[model samples]
Target chain A: MSSTPLPPAAELARANEELRHQLEEAHDLIHAIRTGAVDALAVQGTEGPRIFTLQGADQGYRTLIEQMNEGALLLSDDGTVLYCNACLAGLLQCDLSEVMGRAFADFVPPAFRDYWAGLLLKGWESKSKGELPLQTRGGALVPFSVSMNVLSFNETATLAVIVTDLSAQREITAIRAQVEEQNALLDRKNEELKREETARLAGERAAAEASRLLEGISQIAWTVDPSGANTYRNRRWYDYIGVAPGEGPSIGRAWRERLHPDDAPATLARWNESLRTGAPFEVECRIRNADGDYRWMLGRAQPSRNAQGEVLQWIGTYTDIHEHKLALERIDQGQRELLNYNEQLTRVNVDLDNFIYTASHDLKAPISNIEGLLDALLTELPAETVAREPVQPILHLMQDSVNRFKRTIELLTDVSKLQKEHGLPTEPVDLAAVVRDVRLDLEPLLQSTGAQLEVDVAAAPAVMFSEKNLRSVVFNLLSNALKYRAPGRQPQVHLRARPEGAGVVLEVQDNGLGLDAASEQKLFGMFQRFHDHVEGSGIGLYMVKKMVENAGGRISVSTNLGIGTTFSVLFNR
Target chain B: MPLQKLTCVLLVDDDQTTNYLNQLLINRLEITDKLLIALNGQEALDLVQAHCHEATPDCPALILLDVKMPVMDGFQFLEAYDKLPLPEKAAIIIVMLTTSLHPQDVDRVRRLNIGGFLNKPLTKEKLNDVLKNHFNRHLPE
Candidate 1:
């Protein structure tokens, strides 16, 4: 990342020359006017305030004092303020008389007051120009660069001075460098901590002398040369293999000869390939231990090669992983058992569903007979006479049981319907015609109640389904909307279908006596009816859900307690 | 025109109550002289097929079916009915009555060429309506 070099010194000097020339012109004009060689045009101008000068030099001096931008102040050798210009008085936020003789140290902020004090001594003792600090009227510590000279203009040691504010430049530079240094120090500490943590947690601190370090580990570490021979062997490997370290015929082809007959061929091939390619070798093989039992050992090797990629030596380590191998065996067995268990659960679920549907289907007729018998018995007896009779109440109780049985029957039927709802042939069916048919079917209720039923099918999209099922869904939902329309709000049911993502969005919204939040949970539950005032088997939504689900679709509801409810169903394409 | 009574009626149902009530109702109306009972659609199909070739016309004239039955329901019966051999003497009029609140069942009955559907607890009025509109037994002279 090379950067462009800045301009040469001569070009910078030329720019500096131009700037100094401009500075000299302004400086000389101010000095000459301060000597009162000319009239002050501002005083004689038409618009300015009237000023009468007794001496031309005094006028020029006043003009120069007003024009100077710096806060100029002159102090007596005895530390009294001899003169203070308007700029200086404004800077101090005080009347000229107040500051004209005040001690200068009182206004400078504490942090830089010593620097100002030092510079004050420099004027009488040694060099007269230096950098100092001052406190603004607002109490801010401001740094100023001062250039002063001991002068003989009035036959006394009057001063000629120039001051420049350097506070902003200095603060910007100091804070930036300080923040960068702190960040760098924090980074260095974080890196060292990271290294120490890695050393402690991962045991990854490397050793430069490999042979001396490998001597202390539980793992069996050794060197194997390019030819299928052990150049060295660790004591752990010899002990585990039921062999003495040096009692073996020198660490040669003896180990390979000791490899179990089953592992020898594959191990020899992998080793030869590893040496040929100078690739790291890793393998898990069983070895006979001192206890006369076979244990799984994970072997890994790093090949040290010369410049020609020729093998120098191979450092190999072996770790016993018999426990891990057995755990994997156990996991495989558990997975097989789990698969068998899942199959059993599926079979049981199907059996349960079948039992429910069969039992409910079988129970329906007897319960129906009880209901019909009770109705017949009631009709045979007098209605008014049975209003209080014990037998009548008992019959009513039977009827209640019969109703519950019927409800259970309905639920079982719905569940069976859900199971049977598969593979329905679909094609585009006119929703408008379905809506019209539903309207015609509900005409009697609409006419009797004078519920203003409006069917707006012009904007609805025709979705695909079995026309019979779709018609029923539309009719039941519309009738439900009309039946449950909020009392006194002029029952308005809006059934609109439109194209939505991957399907049709059918929204049946109504100004109905909306269901409470508690009831909303079981809104689509079989035999769960929210409002008893309207005639509902409570299976409408359940049936609707079955139909939609069977069609690979979904339906949902949103409602406000007193205001309204909307049932929006989305059918998949 | 003269009103001719059915010789025998077939009652097919998995439920004994529906069979009994429908039998009683048919007997009370004197719509048939003999009532034959079949537990399922397969039985109904077999019985009707066996009696289809009657020499002296002592066969079932009407068949009442309960839609939700085990083994073989009304729809299954209709599916099997098309295959069963029946004679002109049988004059079999298949009528479906189900307790299913689903409109799909009613639509399915009409579409499958089954006679018709009515609410359960089969009534005399419903039977009379079925006879008048479906069979139109008393044809105008």
Candidate 2:
């Protein structure tokens, strides 16, 4: 309001400097107010200059900032800490007075100094946040998230920084990471346990399947341990023994109680030997069945061995063989009886042969004696008595009777001799030669009967027979053919030999006074005569049959009445 | 040539008729001056014991034996004769005469100390053969 004079040059310069300094102070004051850095201000009033404060109006907000868990701070543009909350001081492990008016960068570790500087520079431009480790008063580094904001009150700038005390947060993060690792380990252990459980279950299933298979077999199958303790038995074993499931007797008791008394000892001995030697065992024994009857059984066992060639167990089976054994015993008994019968028959035959021989011998002596006596009488008789008609005829008749009797006795002797020759040694006899000899012997008879004799032995020439027997057979057959000739026709005879099955067949065919069926049946009987017209002792055919049969040959005669007769003899060699 | 006559000839058989016939044959042959007959081998053995106790002309020189008998057989007599105490018993000529040529009888006679065998119904030819073979003498034809 008052006028003033101009000052000099040096003095005016000094005055201008003072005024500029004052103007700068005024600007700072305005910026501090706008930025809310100053809580109170002093102003000129009407009466006097008065001081004013915003403490009452912002008390709740100020208290909230002081008690916040986050560390709060106000910093100058040059990184100097102008103000700090208690929480910030507590976070740094320092007093609030010590933290105030210090460079905020001083609390940052050396390794993070550049990052702090960068955060401050960015904070001046806009909002900025960063994570870094800050050194506490105790010299331990703690992780912190720093959030910075540039506060401007009409160009008066300050940095508002929120620092999270990351110690608790870092502990939480470490704890969480440890928990995740433990969970992963637990998962791996669980997977391994599942795989092991699957393998164990599979092994158990296989064991169960093997046991089921053993139960299905038909034979009385069983198993025993190396020590001969019975381990397992099939269902069939239980069924055959008439025992309930799981109720069978032990092996020792079974041998004593179930096996027949006579067989138990042998069965046990064999089993013991097999066990001791580790060899396969087999036995035939009688066992009492469910019906309390003893039956034959064939028991067999084979040792099961391991890789070391040591016996592990024995597998066994029992088979019934009762019926077969009984049948064999019966057959043995029958054979013994048959042999005894054969011996008795042989004895009887021998006795009969001896009797026949003795009788014939005795009979022959008497008959021959009679003939001799007759001869003596005839020799003594006078020639005149022999010439008398009736006396001569009677003498002739008597002589004929005596001759007949003698011949009969001689034939009987031959028959008895034939029985003795049954076992005589035989040789291959030429049938042709025998036939030739027989023909010569019968030559007179053949000529008298005018019988044509034909001989053909080309087919089968030899037979295994006694030579004497063969001669007798041929002679009898040939003579009969000539002797029994037809009265009206000349007798024709054919003698032939041929081969049969493993033998020779000789056939004598004759055209003679063939007999009827009735006469032919008795033709071969001793002392049998078919034709009254022919003179015969009737022993010729009988002797022939006997000789042929004794030499293991058979004679069969086929005849047509009054036409022809054929005699076939089959000789077995 | 006619053979020298024997001192004695014995005939044995179970049948009387057979013995008679054998005796006649020996007589007709003129082979022995003395002839004896027996019904069985036992009777013949008794006759032998009575006459042939010593080796002399009285002892039988020839014996015609029959096989079958009730008390004893020809074979039985032969066995007893072998044990006899008579001196020169081997000198006696024994000939078997039988109705049967049974192989058993013939074999038994041959095994014995017999000179020869003859079938039943004694004949001059048969006797001559026996006389010539055993006694070095034969009946004349």
Candidate 3:
């Protein structure tokens, strides 16, 4: 028994009016009972059954049932609608009589008749509740929640039911379900948006990193659109060219403007061809910087194409190759200078040979004339007529001078001949034959000197040399050996040839007055002789050396003073 | 002497001393009755012309020609003499006398129409050999 508190004055006045109307209706109901219109009042209470006079306060429970907001009804075990409140008739949209005798199951849709039956079976308990659609007067289905209980009225079993309209609850439940669905959809969309944002940020970061890497490289990087318009340049491009941002347009135009005039036309032609054909482009040209100095740059580019093979852009680089070009030019200049110097040296050598030739040729006549005069004088002035020839010794000395002079002239001629590279043809000469011939030629000298010549040409049989030059070389060496023999020792000469390394070595070993280290140093020089006592022009060994060198050979000497000397001639293959 | 007497001798040289010496040697040998001297190839040509123009010409039996002279050299004279008449130049013993026995000069002389090449100052023995080879006369030893 919880009592509601009094409302405000505005609601109290409405309540007082509603109570007066209810009293009038209650008065009319009492009047009807007194006139025998209303007979009895029956109620099924928690305590069981109760019957009361219509005039008593027990009738208020009937009134309360009729005035309740929920529909109230009672039914027989056979499913007949035995009793119903005004609210039940109103909720069904029908009169009270129309509801009173109809089957209770008739108000439920046919689809829910079995559910009503199941509810009725379970109505023996204190109460049972179920949801079902009820049929309205207009033949529409209205959803309701029904509570039913098995009760006894007037000593007979009946069912008491309470019905609640569930359309509003159903609508509210549908709205809540829609809100949950909307929330799920919103959350999914928000997640997708967040991922998209993150991907966009990552892509931007990657592009930035790629740009930074391109700028960090030393070479200038640039890009052009498919139309050959300059689209982008890396930071290094500005730094290298000393240009401000956005100054250049249409790389072709900028290149033509800054390119060395000598290189522009060709470079542009190649560039245009590449652009037209979408082919890779490469060229070396001088590019001028902001300081107006030109440096050689090697530019190369390749087109980026789409799947359809349409060119999208071009990526290119320019590399500085100035230093390398300059280095090559310097090397070329040096080679040219070296060739000129070689030519000049060759001319000088020819001039020297000519001078020697004329000088030696001119000196011979005077020497011969002096010798002839001396001979004539000696013959004409007979020893008996002289009595005492004082001029005779002077004449002999003069003859000796003429002879020496003649020998010097002959040596000069030989030297000049050796110096000329007149392509003298060589043959394989038998050293044995050469030695035998030289020995025979020196027979008179050998007999006079009483020298023993030992020949051993077995080691190396033949050598490649000019015949005339070999005869001269052998004659000079053998005569030297015979002339310069040790005072008390008979000249023992050994001429041998053998292969040493890649060349033939000829050794003329003699037991002669050997040379000292100091003499050996100047031994092969022009007019150099170790023993002045011997009759020599001091030019034999020098001629031999020149002859050997002219034939691309070398000569060396080994000697121990007062012991022996060996001259080795190495003829290269 | 291994050489016989000759009708006359011709000396062609650029140096007076060389000619004089050669003439003295010829006289000493007593090989020729007369000796004619010319300083160069041009003078020698004039002498030969003069001898040929004479009514009783004293044609030289031997002509000793020296090389390396002014006006005309030995090879140049030989080229010019090739154009001369056969009667004026034929049957004359021409010897090349040169101080330079350089192989190239000798090669030049070998290509010429000469009896021999003698290196100066020419010895009596060399001259005797030349006379025996060309004149069919041997010097008395």
Candidate 4:
């Protein structure tokens, strides 16, 4: 506060320092104001340094200037807003022009409007400064602080108000609130994501568990489409069949392809019926497995149906039943064979029983004719002439025939008797002497027939049997040998006995009209004979065989027709 | 049909004594003097049928056939006789006579419409027994 006076050089220097100091203060203020929104730089006119002051002038700019300096808004009495700044109005989404001369109460939010008026009244009366919140048009609250002072200006007194916009100043307080809201939203979203992930994980776990359970099912579970194609299978089916899993399906065929030829038709028929009827299917068949062996198997299946009652697939299982099927077949075959064998045995028994009956009936015609002829001849012959002359020949023939018939009947009786009595002749006998006697007895007939008898009685030693039966056996054999003497050749006979094991084997071989193969088999029959033209009864040889058999011996014959015949008698050792 | 052409008859059998006696009885009847003679049944049938087919036809009015004979039996003669047809069935008289009494032969002979049946050893008395039944049936009708 000094008056103007100075030397030109001294005055210029002092004025320059003063002007520089004032310029420095203005630059600092402008710098501080321009730092946010209000530009406070003031340039001096070249003529002189100027001093200017405006009261209640451009309150919006002033307030803006204060707000830029980080200050609050000030309100006047009567609920009138004295000023607002660019920062406050802009944050309120309100125009600076609309904020000027506006009633502060009108600017208040409806909820806070009364509260604001009361607080302002109290603040003005008490001459206090209070912090308040103001509503922006964006519906956000802007914080502010106002100082009230009574002023006497012009004629009446009004409140001298100072406003400080605290929008940025309150920003520090609201940071925690923003952080809390963001954290809440983030937490909610994280929870939702966690729930979704858990659901997805549970689904995956269920799917895995289902797959594991599917593997544990051991049945040869197989699926086939309605079109008769295989789609799926379990492990046991292939394992039981001894084939590679899925091999049958891979070959463009179903598992039925492995069935044996004999079983294929039945298996296919059952399957076709099942498919047509939508019923359960079952079959047993032989399967040619991978190991190249055929095994029986049973397959059972049922159709899987959809909600519409349409068949979707057939699910089935396979089992091994070869042993059971084969066993049943074998038992059936055995029963059939047994039945056939029993039938044969019954037929043979009937034949054996009927043989004699049938033979007698057939032979009676000739035998009765001969009997009638004999009766007639006997009637014609005189009682005294019965033994004489021309009648003698007829008598001889008839007598011989009667004798043959009587002998044959006796032989038949002996054979039948042999069958029942198996008692052996236990007496020891000289088989050698008996055979010699037989040769001597047959000497006359043998000479007439030109038959030679060679006896080898020493070969078998002594045998146990009735000597009388043995003599008859040898005599019947030698006489039969002479009777069967051949036409062109003289008969040579050999009768021999040889020791065999613990007994004797007697053989009589004759060179004569030898027995034919068919006649040889029948040589030992009751009245069997070779050469119907030969004289004497057929029973001579027959009785001889019966005696031998009754003596615990066996009889057999070997012969070459047109050569010699041998009759063998084997006594058990 | 005429008296001079009165048909003759022959009977054949193996029993010679039966044949002689039957001839003696037949001569007494005088049915024909031109008597044909044969022993065996074959020769008898042949001689009788041979004489029958002659132009002056001496068809035997009666042939006494036996059921049994030697060489060829009476049954064989009956079989051979079946092959022949009588020119005049009334003019031919054939009779089966035998000692054989088998039912099968009795049934067989009943089917033959012969003159009459006469038993063996034909005497006048038994012959009259036959004349009563046969001679009455053979008259004009």
> Model 4, A449-520: lDDT tens per residue?
877778886767687877777787778777777777778887888888889898888888998778778878
Clashes of each: 2, 2, 8, 10
Residue pairs in collision within model 3: B1-B139, B1-B140, B1-B141, B2-B138, B2-B139, B2-B140, B3-B138, B3-B139
Cα lDDT for residue A476, model 1?
73
Off by over 4 Å in 3: A1-241, A244-290, A294-338, A379-387, A428-463, A467-501, A505-514, A558-568, B1-8, B30-34, B46-61, B85-87, B91-93, B114-116, B133-141
DockQ of 2: 0.53
TM-score of chain A of 2: 0.52
Candidate 2 Cα errors over 4 Å, as ranges: A1-285, A297-335, A375-399, A436-456, A485-496, A511-528, A536-557, B1-6, B20-57, B124-141
| Tens digit per residue, CA lDDT, model 3, B46-87 | 777777544233778788999989998777877877776656
> Each prediction's TM-score against the native?
0.42, 0.59, 0.56, 0.29
RMSD (Cα, Å) of model 2: 17.1
Q: How do the residues A89-121 of candidate 2 rate in per-residue lDDT, one tens digit apiece?
A: 998999976887678888898989998899888
- DockQ per model, Cα: 0.21, 0.53, 0.40, 0.02
Docking class of 1: incorrect
- Candidate with top DockQ is 2
- Which residue pairs in model 1 clash with each other? A486-A511, A486-A512
- Quote the B-chain TM-score, candidate 3: 0.89
